[model samples]
Target: MEKNQSLVEENEKLSRGLSEAAGQTAQMLERIILTEQANEKMNAKLEELRKHAACKVDLQKLVETLEDQELKENVEVIRNLQQVITQLSDETVACMAAAIDTAVEPEAQVEISPGSSRSSDAFTTQHALRQAQMSKELVELNKALALKEALAKKMTQNDSQLQPIEFQYQDNIKNLELEVINLQKEKEELVLELQTTKKDVNQAKLSERRRKRLQELEGQIADLKKKLNEQSKLLKLKESTEHTVSKLNQEIRVMKNQRVQLMRQMKEDAERFRQWKQQKDKEVIQLKERDRKRQYELLKLERSFQKQSNVLRRKTEEAAAANKRLKDALQKQREVTEKRKETQSRGMEGTTARVKSWLGNEIEVMVSTEEAKRHLNDLLEDRKILAQDVAQLKEKVESGENPPPKLRRRTFSLAELRGQVSESEDSITKQIESLETEMELRSAQIADLQQKLLDAESEDRPKHRWENIATILEAKCALKYLIGELVSSKIQVSKLESSLKQNKASCADMQKMLFEERNHFAEIETELQAELVRVEQQHQEKVLYLLSQLQQSQMAEKQLEESVSEKEQQLLSILKCQDEELEKMQEVCEQNQQLLRENKIMKQKLNLLQVASRQKSHLPKDTLLSPDSSFEYIPPKPKPSRFKEKFLEQSMDIEDIKYCSEYSVNEPEDSDGDGGDGDDEEWKPTKLVKVSKKNIQ
Candidate 1:
């Protein structure tokens, strides 16, 4: 039983050892994985460092190709120092990694044997030492990386500083190149000037008169230059004023066009008024002609009526004379009859039959006389009615109303009335001749009857006497009635003659008035013609004056243009002279730079030789010249003063020209103050003139 218990305890001890060995091996494998991860991280860091080292080498090569010798040498020194530092850091890191690998390989081999605890303890201690060494190496590598980063920062700072210096150097080189080109131009100009001087010297030596002439020409040239400057100033002022002047011209043209339109309108209105007046006058003349013709027709009618009344009056006078004669004869017969009756009373019974026959004859005579009296009365009534009609017609004609239809029909032209009056006179004459023939026959019968009655009275005087006495009384009554009608007709004729005289007077007055009106119209026409002629003359004069003024203004504008052109030419010449002066200045700057370079070179050489002599101790100090004595300071020539004087003169001339222009522009306004009346009253010219004056000022 004791042998079996001892065997069980040995088996328990073997199992415990195996479990411990397995746990230790698992721990070692975990540590190895951790170490491999650390190694991969270190390798990535080294590759980054190698890439940075390669960029630094490229920078060194770029710096070696620099144009500046001093900067290139400095960059080379910094680049070599950085490369040596990087190589030392890389070698140290590689050695540390190799020692860590050698130490870890033995720790891994010893860990595989699970029976030896002392060997495992020794492996742990060695691994600890290797980890400590690796830690120290990592610290050193980190310090080296920090140093490299600081160097890169310093190098970048240096490169940043040098970039601006290089840009400045390039700028200075370009400036020098430009200066050299300008210097060449100046050299050419100087050669031309020298040639000209030589010519002038030769001409001066040839004749004293020529030298005096050259001086005179120089003085003239100076004067011309002054004039040119003044002209240029004036041209500038003129250019500024041209816009205003052109605007004024446009306004003037517009105003002139308006004026022309207004004049045309006025002329049209005048012509229309004249035509209307002429038309009205023609109408008035036509009316007057119509009135004159009417009056003439009325006068003709009156004349015809007067002629008819005169003929009627003559007929009445003739009738009255015949009646008077008949009455006288009748009275004589009645006396004779009474005497016969007295003689017959003594023998009353002797002749009774003879007295009855005589009474019958006397009764026939009384009936004839009564019939003639009735005819005369009818004629008188006709004359009275005709007279009344004539009076009414005269009244209507005088009152200027239309005549009655009867009068209108009776009215005739002058020629027709004259012919009618002649025809009526001829008819009246024929009637009077017939009446006289009948009266002669009746008178003869009366004579024969008187003879018969004397014979019968002797036989029976008492019987016939009473009947003859009664017949004589009746005849006397008839004769008295005819005489009254004749007197009335004579009075009416006289009234008609008076009215005709008054009508004649009125016609004469009307004719005189017509003549006077014609004279007045003629006088008015003459006056209108005279006024029209005068107005036309005034308009012509005004137009001519305006044309002349326009011509003068145009001429002035042409002169201004010519002056402007001349000024422009002078300005071009002045600009060319300024360019030449700029070239001369550039040449002077180039000379200054060359002299400074020579002085610096001489100083450097003197310092070097002095240092060499001191080292050799053989060369004498007296042989080399002193720095200050070797280089003589020669000052550059001063710039010409004429250009500055010309600039100042040009400025002064511009001011003077401005003042002159102002004065000239204002002068016209002062002069124009007087002629404000007459045609100058036109608004366009005055306003334009004023505007021009204001703009110029």
Candidate 2:
């Protein structure tokens, strides 16, 4: 019952835990959804900000245009606009950071929980970890939201600040537009004035000074054009030369590549040859070693043969001494038999014959030993010849030539010679052993003969001593021959060493010459390169100088053009002022002529009145009553004066003047039937005369 209660309790705890986990998961999902929504809102706001930024960019482009037009006064406005853009960008960055933080936090919190929940303990641990992560993420999200709100407030503040600037910028734009319009109007007026001046200048005859200036300007323009053509030709030539140089350089590069490939091929061939040579050298060395071993073996054999020959010579000397002792002993016995035969005649005869036969046998044994010595000397000569043949064969093999049939035959002969030598050596050893054994037996016999002849051989001992001296002389001659051979070999070695040293010296000289040639070639190359560089620099300098000259000529041309335009404008203004002064003078001359004409009319009227008064006094009152007695007075014609003629000519030359005739008032002629003298008194002459003015075209 107790176990069952415990199990029920555990089951209830597990259920409670699962309920808490489900609630946590639900809250997490809600937070995730909220974060996603916030991200969406932030993205939309960012898009709106991007649109505003694009508008600002357009404004920036306008400011840049103004700058290009040299509107320095608007620098401050451009700076303010740039500052606003920077502030907005900074705000957008901050908002984006906040949005990213908010969006990433929930995902990070969810990821914090382990994927697998294999046991209750693991599930509980995962839940706890998730809960902790969620709390941290919530705090981070709240901070991000606060940051975002603060950024929004800053943006609003910046927008408020930017509003007045935008208004001012618009106002500045309007003012600039007005200034541009005024400038355009002024430009139009100047253009019109220039056109009128140009027309006048073209229509009027140019003064001598102006004509000269125009001719000079044309000449200068022609010269400039010619220079430009020349420069262009030179540039074309330079371009062609540069193209040819490039082609040459390309060819040189190709040649260098070919050379490099050739050098590589040569190096590969040299390496292959060197490898082949090394293999051949190794074979030669092996052959030399084999020859050296064979020679060493031959030397050992020769040494052994020489020792055996010495031993045989000693044995031969010992046998000669034994024979000499036996000869002495027999001579003494012969002397005794002769004395005994003289005393006992016929019985001693047989004994004397036996003694003579024994002496003949000893001489035959000495002849056999001399024959054996001659055979051994013959064998030694044959061995030396074989050795020489082997040396020649080895030389042929080391010379790196294919062996001919003769050489192959010689190699076979050498093997045969080797076999023959070994066989002869064995035979010689057997012969030496037999001679040693024979010498021992002869020594024993010599000892017995020496005992027998001890009393009788003192006289023959000098001859035996002379024979030993001859043997010693022969051994000394052999030693001298060997010493002579050694001296000759030493001379040959010294000659070889000298030749090798000379070869080395010659090789060193050749190498030095090669090094010097390489250095000379390198120096020549360096000098050529330096010369090429100097030429290039000179060419570049010439090009630069020509360009500068061309630029200066262009500037001079512009200056001359400006000066000519200014001079033309000055000349035009002078002409206009002169024309106005001439018109004024013409008006003054016309006024003077009208005043003179009026003066002439007044004088004529005065003369006529004076004449009428004189006639009235001369006639009687009674005669004046008659009509037939009245006289008519005529006015004289006015003659043209020189000054008037001159003035009229001048006015005619200047402009055409038209004259109109005015009505002349003539004094009333006396009536034919007039009865009243009082009628003449009542008709007074009118004084007012109308003068017409001439119109000058």
Candidate 3:
């Protein structure tokens, strides 16, 4: 007390309420950290949902394989035609060799003329044999020419049909690659956030460890202070007692002087001595009691302090473990983000390769667009030439003139052979329709599968059950593969339809050509009027039957037309519903992204608190942010211990920023301020979408 008499009043003036509020705030901050973690988890889920909504599946390989199958089928037909040609060629060659050998030896045939008449017969027979061989060779050449022509037609049909679908497939693959890249970027961002979180957690653990150690050291210092206070009190009490005793002696001396005057000198001396003895005894007892009470109080205080220290140690351990776990999680997140980015890049590359392959390599099935147009022009020119030739023949016939022998001898109906192009149009139409339907159904089913997965997770089902469901979904994808055959068949049908339309036009040209040819044939047969008349009747009957079949097909098309119109209306309704759902999904994704950003910021703030633990002096207002906070939102706080700050900041700069997700809705609904549902009307749900862009920190 004597050594520091001026400090007592200053120490007594600070109230208890302010200390309590500081403690409550510390606890509040801890809860905030926990909340931020929850927000991070929520944000991740939201991001996943957003990705699922926007994600597109790739099917390029399947499409290419389908085209290959078509090529194979077309090649099969060509192969059959080639085989027929080969057979005819072999027969012709065999027949030719026999005729040539026989014709070369007419002398031998004459030697057998003793049977001279028989020899003449043999020579005549050899001539017949040679003539038969020539006829066979002619037939073989005609068949080979027909097969070549048919192959050319098939190639043209396939090239036209698969070209559009291949282009569309390639485009879709490119879009998917872009989406994958975006998703990967998002994942990388998340991972970086996680890494920052891990650093914060580690810092938190170190700070907590330091805090516990400091608390222990403070407790020990307080114990020492208590001992020092007790000793000082004892020293002061002893000094005061001595001072009082000295004063009492002086008073006794004064009393002795007075008593000597009042009583006898001997009585005064005895009374003073007895009183002094009794005072000494009383002082000794008081000192002993004081020491005992101080000792008891110190023992009780140490016990209470020790219990608190133990509790603090346990808490410190728990906090350290939690911090480590959080740091680990953050590290994992960072790694995952990096991996996601890498995966995205790889996927993009793969997609590009696939698109290029589909478009570039499948040449046998489809030619380039330019080539198709050119081929079309060529076909038109060919048809024109055929028509002109037919017209001239018809004119000659109409003039009642006999046709030249050359024209009659080399009769080849190229127009009749090319009418098969109509089949290609039918196949191409069916292919496109089926492919579109399959794509739509697959997309919808994927959505449904994702929804079911969400429901299962929300219901807290076990992993095994979800796995079973996943298996079922996989089986369905397999089922789609099995349906590939049907899809391919539809593709063929579409191609056939396209071919049918083109061939129909050709057929019309062929019909005109046929009429001209018929006229020419009629001229050739002018010497045999009955024969010409019979052939004409037969041809007319066949044409009439074909026309009847065509009329019936038209009637069938009309009936199907009404049903298709209704289905198209239904498809429109479904599209609108999908748009609404996508809108909601988009909103959720934005919220998740926002929440993640907020979590990262707050985690940095928690880390700042750790750095603040070792601080011994106040920090500047601007330099206290952690890395997670965006540049503008960091708040400044006074530093407590400079040593802590110095050691923590040695390896890494502490930005000391804090993030709070307290913003409002940022929904992409009616950015024009209204959903365009009304004009000059009070804002309502119908007219305006209340997009609450909440900060989901």
Candidate 4:
């Protein structure tokens, strides 16, 4: 009972274990299904992203747009500022012209009054000539003042015309700035969203079903890994690719550094250009003021000449007798005036030439810088492309898309990548050093130019000031052009930076994808391993159960054989006992047959003796029928057979035979009365017959 109870308990436990295993398997399957669904969804999302990649709001494009817009606004502002500066210059020129006219008028009037007083005593041809010259000078002065007033009025009109345009441009700039800010905010928000998505993806948990599928997936993973590893040629290809990529990366880094240096140089150039522009603007303003002063001084000189002519006319009338002397003096004065004009013209020409030469040099410098910047930009673009290619190669390496066949190959690839990266870094360092040297040289050149400008300013002659003013105006125009170029360069730099940022984002995205793929592969491998373990465990259990069942069957068969053999042995023993009993009954039957034969013989002899006695009894009754009849019967009877003596005489003589026969018949009936052990009692008649025979003997 205890054993039965124990078996029942074991069966219940086994059933529970089986149920638990089945449940676990079911859960595992469910998890696997869920994971598969998730994988499908992820694949769909990837597809969607691919499809929309172009359509998406590219940050680089937006940044470029903003930069372009800003550059445009800056250019407009610079243009407006230039216009204002020109207008101011014009106004100053007009004011100087008016001042010159005023100063000349007063001097001419004072001199004419003195000449008129001297000529009061005489009205000669000399007086008339003096009056005519004075009138012509007055008219010229008045015309100059009128022209100056008209020019000032035109400048004012131009200023009024520019005011509204400038205001409108300012408003437009403000609106563009606001839009740029909004776009920047949007870009930041998008970046935050991207980060959140990445975090969520990272935080996602593995499902139970996926865990269960791990083992089943192992074989597939092995096959895939095997295929990935089988390409020996690919390993060499990968190595070469890595080398190329490394070389490219190094070249790219060198180029990038060069580009950076170029950009820095451009920035320095732009700053210097701005400074030069400011200095030139200041110089232009100073020159304009000086030119005005020079104009006023020239007007004063003209007035003095006009006054001298009036005084000479008065003296000529008074000293008509000394007309020849007066003529000689006038000739000398004319000669002196001619010499002074010639010298002034020469000075103006020389100063103008110098200023033009300076401007040409500055323009040449600007053009050279622009060309260098363009060359650097082109190099930067080339470097950017190379960097992109290198990044692609790195991504391919990291992605393990065509993984190396073995650990050694993988290591080789890794080493190659590292080597390439190191080489590139070294190259970049060298390039940077070279660029730094170049930048220093350029800086020195700029300093020299600045020093030259300072020297020119310090050594400038007073007479050449007007010439300098004209040169300053030309320089201001150059500065405006340079400012525009600077703005353009700045825009280009911003575009490059934006491109770089975009490339970085793309590279980061690719890295993320590679990492995800790697993680997925690892997860799959783990799942496959787990599934394999579970399957192996299940197989082992099944094998154990089958083995146990086989053992149980063998044991049952052995027990059955044992029980069958025991039964057979028992049957044989029963058969032998029955055979022994049957033989004893046969012996009793033979004895009974013998007793029957003896009884038959005794009956025949008794019949014969009875007949003889009956016949003799009629004639010799007195002779034979005496008291000794028993002796006469004994003499007549043949000696009873041994069978009769034993069988009949043991129990009965003639009477004993009858009694024994009757007793034998009665014994058989008595033996038949009880049925228990009846077969054993069935031979009792033979035993009784034997006993009766012994008693008869």
Query: Per-residue error at 110 for model 2, in Å?
Result: 84
CA lDDT, every model vs. true structure? 0.49, 0.52, 0.43, 0.49
Number of the top TM-score candidate: 4
State the displacement of the C-alpha of residue 457, model 4, in Å, after optimal TM-score superposition: 27
Between prediction 3 and prediction 4, which has the larger TM-score? 4
By summed lDDT, the worst window of 10 consecutive residues in model 3 runs over: 657-666
Please, what are the lDDT tens digits per residue for candidate 2 over residues 250-359? 65455435534543443454355457556656765665556556556556655765675576567556555655645554565456445544643333333333333333
Candidate 1 similarity to native, TM-score: 0.24
Candidate 1: stretches off by over 4 Å: 1-224, 230-266, 342-375, 387-697
CA error at residue 424 for candidate 3, angstroms: 75
> How many residue-pair clashes does candidate 3 contain?
53
2 against 4, candidate with superior TM-score: 4
Q: Sorted on lDDT, highest at the top, how do the candidates line up?
A: 2, 1, 4, 3
lDDT of 3: 0.43
lDDT of 4 by residue, 1-697 (tens): 8997567555444433333333333333335435535754754554454445342434443444665777767655655654555565556555545644554453333233222222211322233333334333433443443444445445554555665755665565566556555655555554455445533434333333333444444544455445444443444554564565555556545543553454344345435545755665676566445445644644664465456445534433333323233334334434544544554455545544444444444444334344344433433443344345345435544553222111221112224445544554454344345445434543443354344334333453225433433446455655655577689889999999999999999999999999999999999999999999999999999999999999999999999999999999999999999999999777655666655666666556544554554454344545655786543433221222443455543333365466655643543344335433433311311211235544223
The regions of model 2 sitting more than 4 angstroms off are 1-202, 206-217, 343-697
Quote each prediction's TM-score.
0.24, 0.24, 0.13, 0.25
Alpha-carbon runs more than 4 Å astray in model 3: 1-564, 576-580, 583-587, 590-594, 610-614, 617-697
Query: Is 2 or 4 the stronger prediction by lDDT?
Result: 2
